[model samples]
Target: PISAAAFGVAGPIVNGVAKITNLSWTIDQIEVAHALDLAADKVQLLNDLEAMATAVPFLLPEDVQTLNTAEPVAQRPIAVVAPGTGLGEAFLTWNGRRYVAFPSEGGHADFAPGDSLQLRLLNYLAPQYGHVSVERVCSGIGIPNLYAFLRDEKIAEEPQWLREMMDQVDDIVPVIIQHAFDKAAAVPICVQTMEMFAHILAAEAGNMALKLLSRGGVYLGGGLPPRILPMLQAPRFMELFYGKGRFAQLMAQIPVYIILNQRTGLLGAGYAALALDESL
Candidate 1:
C-alpha cells in the first residue's frame, strides 16, 4: 500500500489548501486524499519551487551547466529561482537530518530597475500594471511586455511581418524567443527583448543570493533558462549579476548554474513523500 504522497503546487499552500497562482483550481489535501482513497494525513503539499529545491542535492553534474564555480560552502543554504509562465523562488537549508525546502513569494516583489532603459521600461509598464512586479518583466509573459516596450517606445522597429506573426500565434513568448535565437535573419527587437530579459533575470538572481546568503549556490530552474543557454552565457548577463556596488566581490564568489532537469520538481516531491513515510 502507498504509505504517503506529496505534491508540488505552483502557489502558496495554507491550511492544507493550495491556491495555485496561475490556475483557477484550488488543491485541498483532504480532497486529494479522498479522491485517492488515502488518509488525508498521508498527503503533503509544497510549492513547486520548494519541491525543485529538494532535488538540487540529488542533481547530477550532467543535469546542470555551471556558469560560476565559486566553491559552494557545504551545508549552507541554497536558492532556486525560475522564470516560466510566472517567476518562482525558493530555498533549501540543512536541518541536521536533511535539507528542507522553504517556498517564498519573492517573485512578486517590486521590480527594481538597474539602468535608465530599465527605468523607462518600468515607466511604460506602470500605467498598465499599476504595480510592476519582477514577474512582470522576468517571466514568459514578461518577454512580450519587454518586446512591446522596445517597439512602442521607438527603441526598435516593429516590422509588419513580426507583428502579423505575433498576432496569429496563440502564445507569442516562444515565437519571440525563437526569433531572438535566430541570428541569421534575426528580428532585432526580439533579440533585444531577450537581452533585456536576461539582464533582469540575472539582476534578480543576484538579489536573491544576497537576500538569503545562499553560499551553497544559486540554481536557475525554469523552462526558459535551459533553452536560452547561449543568451545567458553572454558577458552582459554576468556583468549585471556582478553589478552590486559594495558586494560585487561577494556576488562574484557565489556559484551559479542552470538546472537542466525539468523533472526536478517531481523528483523533489518524491523525496518529500519518502521523508513523510519515514517519519510515519
Candidate 2:
C-alpha cells in the first residue's frame, strides 16, 4: 500500500488535472489516487521539467558530467533544458528554506535564428509551420524536420541506402543519429543533421542561461544529450553555446552539465513525495 506518490507529467498541472502534451491523455490527481488506492492528498503532480529541476539538488556526482568548468554560485538560480518528444524548460531558486522549481512552456517560444544557414532553414520551415517554435527544430520530432530540410534544400545528399533505412523505421531520428555516429556508414547527410541539431540545442540552452541568469548552473537533460555526448563535447557545440556576441564571456563562465542518469524525473517525484511526508 502506497502512502504517498508524485507524478512528473509532460504538461502543466492545473487544478490537479494535466492535459499531457504530445499525447491524448488527460490525468487527474483524484483519478490517479483511485487507480493506485492511495489517499487523495498523497498524490502530487508536476511538469516533467519541474520534476527534473527538483531532482537537481539530490543528484550524485556520478549522475552528471561537467560540460564546462565554470563554478556554481551557492543558492543561485538553476536552469534546466530538456529536448525529448518536446523541448522542456524549468528553473529552481531558493525560497528561504528550500529550492522551489518553477515549470515553463518556454519551448514553444519563437525560434530565433543566429546565422545565415539557420535563417534559410527558418524560411524553409516558415511556410509549413506559421510560427516556428524552438521545439519545432530542437526535439525528437525536430530532427526529421531538419533532416528533410538538408535533403530537399540540397545542403546535403540523402543517399539511397539512408533513404531505405528511414523508410523502414517509424521514428527516423534514431536511424539518422545512428548513422551519423557510424563513420563506416559514410552518411554525410546524417552527420550534418546531427551537427545542426547540436547547434540549435546549444543555442537554445545559451538563450535560457541568459534569460534566467542561472548562475548556479545549467543542466542539459533529455534523450538526445546522453546519446550524443560525443557531439556535445566537440568544439562545434561549445562554439554555438558561447557565440552570444556581447555575452560570450559570461556564457563561458556559466557551469554546464549533461544529466547522465535517465531516472532524474522519477527520482525528483520520489523526493517530492518525501517532502510531503515531512510536511504532514
Candidate 3:
C-alpha cells in the first residue's frame, strides 16, 4: 500500500492548497488525501521548481550537460531556474544532514534591465503592464513580446511569409524558434528575439546565483533550455551571466548546467514521497 503521495504543482502552496498559476485549477491537500484514501498529513505538495530541485543531487552525469565547469563546493546551496511557459525558481540549502528544497516566486519578481536596450524594452512594456516582472521578458510567453518589440521598433524586418505564418498559429513561439534555428532560411527577427531571450535568461540565472550564493551549482531546467541548447552554449550568454560587476569572479566559479532529463520532476516527486514515508 502507498504510505504517502507527493505532487509537484505549477503554483504556490499555501496551507496545503495550491491555485495553479495561469490556470483555473485548485489542488487541496485534504481533497487529494481523501481521494487516495490516505491521511491528510501523508500528502505533500511542492512547487514544480522545488520538486525539480530535490532531484538535482541524484542526477546522473548522462542526465545533464555542463555549461560551466567550476568545481562545486560540497553542501553549499544550489539554485534552479526554469524558463518554460513561465519562469520558475527554487533553491536547496544544506541542513546539516541533507539538502532541503524550497520553492520561490522569484520569477514573478520585478524585472530590472541590465543594459540600455533592455531598459528600452522595459519602457516599451511599462505602459502595457504596469508591474512587468522578469517573466514578462524572459519565458515562452515572453518570446513573442520580444519579437513584437523588435518588429515594431524596426530593429529587425519581419519577412512577409513569416508574418503570415505567425498569424496562423495560436502559439507563435514554436514558429519563431523554428525559423531562428533554420540556417538556410533563417528569419532575422526570430534570431534577434531568441538572442534577447537568451540574454535575459543568463542575466536572471546570474541574479539567482548571487542571491543564494549557490556555490553548489545552478541548474537550468524546463522545456526551452534543452531545445535552444546551441543558443545557450554561445559565448554571449556566459558574458551576460558574468556581467555582475563586483561579483563577476564569484559568478564564474559557480557551476552552471542544463538539465536534459525530462523525467526529473517525476523522479523528484518519487523522492519526495519516499522521504515523507520515511518520516512517518
Candidate 4:
C-alpha cells in the first residue's frame, strides 16, 4: 500500500527517476519507500493511461462490442480513450508487424460545444469555472455538476422524492442511471436528466474521434460506458457523434465498440508491462 502518493507529475523511480502528476505532495524514491513501507527497489510506478493503451491489441475479440462495422485494425492509427479520474487519451500505430502506444494529455483540451444548446450550456458553465475542459463536462465524475447545472437551468424539474434522494448523496448520476434502467424509481425528471447527460457524452465522443481521425474505429472503454449499456441507443448516439457539419460523411464510416469486460483496463496495464519487459 502506498503510504501516500505525493508528487508533481513525477512517476515512480524506474532507474532513479519518476514524475508523479498530482502535486499535493512531492517525494523521491526514499520518501516513497518510507511512506509505502516497501523496499525502494520493489515499488514501481506506471502511467495509468499508457498502461491501458498498451492493452488494446491484446483485448480478446469478445471483450469489445463493435459499434460501427469496420476491421481496419492493422492498417491505420488506433486510438483508445478512457474516462476514469479524468479522460485519458492514447493512440497506437502499426507498421505491418506490430504496434506501439503513446500516452496523451489531450484530455485537457478545451471543450468545444457543437450546437446552440451546447453553447448555452457552456455559457452557463463558464461563469463558474476558469476554462471548461471536456472532463469538466463529459466524464462520469463531471456529470453531477452538469446535473446541478441542468437543475438550475430549469431544463427539467426534479420531483420532491428525487430531489431529496439526490440531496442525500454526493453523486446522483449512477443512482439515477440505475433507477432509469430499473424503471423502478426513475421519474420523468430523472429520465430527462440522463438523456441530457447521454447527448453531451455523444457529442464529446464525436469530437474526440474527429480530432484523432480514428478511421479504424472508436471503442468506448471507460467505466461509465458499460454501466449505461442498457440505455445506449446506437442510432441516437451515432446521430450526435456524427453530427459535425463538414465531416459527417467521413465520421459515419468509422467503427465504434464498447468494451464490455470490466477487467479491460487491467488487461491493458498487463499488456503494457509485457511490452516494457520485451523492450528490456
Best candidate (score: lDDT): 3
- Each prediction's Cα lDDT score? 0.90, 0.90, 0.91, 0.67
Which digits, one per residue and each the tens of the lDDT, describe model 3 over residues 180-247? 99979888888889999999999999999999999999999988999899999998988888899998
TM-score of each: 0.96, 0.95, 0.96, 0.80
How far residue 70's Cα lies from its native spot in candidate 2, in Å, is 0.6
- In model 1, where is the ten-residue run with the lowest total lDDT? 271-280
Candidate 1 Cα misplacement greater than 4 A, ranges: none
Candidate No. with top TM-score: 3
Which tens-of-lDDT digit does each residue in 6-66 have in candidate 2? Answer: 9998878999999987799999999998998987888899888889989998899999989
lDDT against true structure, model 1? 0.90
Report backbone clashes per prediction.
Answer: 0, 0, 0, 11
lDDT (tens digit, per residue) of candidate 1 on 139-201: 987888999999999999988998998889799998888888886888898889999999999
Query: What is the TM-score (0 to 1) of candidate 2?
Result: 0.95
**Which ranges in model 3 have alpha carbons more than 4 Å from their true place?**
none
Candidate 3 lDDT: 0.91
TM-score winner between candidates 1 and 2:
1
lDDT of 2: 0.90
